[model samples]
Target: MTAVADLFNLKGQTALITGGSSGLGLQIAEALGTQGARVVISARKADVLESAQAHLAGLDVDASWIAADNAREDHVERLANDAMERLGKIDILVNNAGATWGAATADHPLSAWDKVMNLNVRAIFLLTQQIGRLSMIPNRYGRVINVASIAGLKGNGPTSQPTIAYNTSKGAVVNFTRALAGEWGKYGITVNALAPGFFPSKMTRGMIEKVGIEKLAERAPLQRIGDDDDLKGAALLFASDAGKHITGQILAVDGGVTAV
Candidate 1:
C-alpha cells in the first residue's frame, strides 16, 4: 500500500489556479504550493498577482503568475498557453475564478447575467478544455478541482439576497463537475468540485455586511463562518493522489449549513 504521506505528496507536480491573486483562489494556491507543487496562478490584475507571488515566495513555494481575464475567450486562451509553457505540464487545474451579481430576478439585467455566466461557467469550460487537451489527456493523469458554492446545492430562502444569476451559474457548475468527470475518467483524469459556504472574501464582503456574520453563522450548525485554513485540507485531498479514486463528487466546505 502506498504510504499516506506519499499519497498526499505533490513534490514534483505542477498546478494552474485561476483567480488566484486573492480570496479562495489564493487560499487553494497556498495549499497546493505548500504541499510541494509548483504553481502558476492567474487573475486579471498584474499587481495583485505580483503580491500573491511574493507571499508564496515567502512561504518557500515555487510559484509564478499570469494575468488574464477569464471572462474573455482570448485572455483565457492566452492564460492556458502561458501556464502550460511555464509549468511544462499541468498535473492539476483549479477552476476558482468566478463572479456574482446581486439583484432580484425581475430587476436583474441581462448584461449582469451574462457577466456572471461568462466568468463562472463558460470560463471554466474553456480553461478546462484547454488544459485537458493540452496536458492532461496526453499524459493521462490529472486532477481538476472546481470551486463551486453551497448556494448551488439549494435555493435561497426569503431572507437571502435574490442573486438569481449567481445562483443559476453555480448550479450549472455543480452538474458540470459531474458531467466532465464522467467523460474524462476514461482518460485517467479526475474531476471534482469544492462547494464552499460563507467565507470572508472580496466577492462575499457585501453579503457578509448585509447579512451580518453572526446571522450567517447562526444558519450553520457549526455556528461560525469559514476561516482562512478551512479549505486547505479538502483542496489538497482532491488535488493529490489521496483523492485519485474520487471523481465527479462535490465536497461542501460549508460549516454544516447545508445539513440543517
Candidate 2:
C-alpha cells in the first residue's frame, strides 16, 4: 500500500494555474507548491504576478509567474506554449481565471454577457484543449482542476444581485468539467471541478459588501465563509496522486451551503 504521505506528494511535478496572482488561485498554488510541485501562475498584471511570486518565494516554494490575459485566445495559446517551454510538461492545470457581470436578465447587455462567457467559459475550454494536446494527451497523465462556483448549482434568490450571465457561464463550466472528464479519462487524464461558495476576493468584493458578510454567512450551515487555507487541501487532493481515482466530479467547498 502506498504511504499516506506519498499519496499527496507532488515532488517534481509541474502545475500551471490561471488567475493565480491572488485569492483562491494563489491559495491552491501555495498548496501544490508547498507539497513539492513546481508552480507557474498567470494573471493579467505583471506587477501582481511579481508580488505573488515573491509571496510564494517567502514560503520557500519553487514558483514562477507569467502575465497573460487569459480571455484572449492568442494570449492563452502563448501562455500554454511558454509554460510548456518553461516547465517542460504540465502535470496539473488549474483553470481558475474568470469574470462576472451583474445585471438582471431583462436588463443585461449583450456585450457584458459576451465578456463574461468569453472569460469564464470559452477561455477555459481553449486553455484545456491546448494543454491537453500539447502535454497531457502525449504524456498520458494529467490532473485538470476547474474552479467553478456554487452559483452554478442553483439560482440566486430574488433579493440578491442579478448575475444571470455569470451564473449561466458557470453552469456551462459545470457540464464542461464532466464532459471533458468522460472524454479524456481514456488518456489517463482526470478532470474535476471545485464549486466554491462565497470567498472574499476582488471578484466578490462588491457582492460581499452589498449583501453584508454576516448575512451571507447565515445562509450556510457552517455559519461562515471560506478562508485562505480552506481551499488548499481540497485543491491539493485533486492536483496530487491522492485523488488519482477521483475524476468527473464536482466537489463543493462551500461551507455546506449547497447541502441545506
Error of 1 at 113 (Å): 0.2
**TM-score against truth, every candidate:** 0.99, 0.99
lDDT of 2 by residue, 10-129 (tens): 999999999999999999999999999999999999999999999999999999998999889999999999999999999999999999988889999999999999999999999999
Off by over 4 Å in 2: none
- Every model: Cα RMSD to truth: 0.7, 0.6
User: Model 2 — which ten-residue stretch has the worst lDDT?
Assistant: 207-216
Count backbone overlaps in model 2.
Answer: 0
Error of 1 at 220 (Å): 0.5
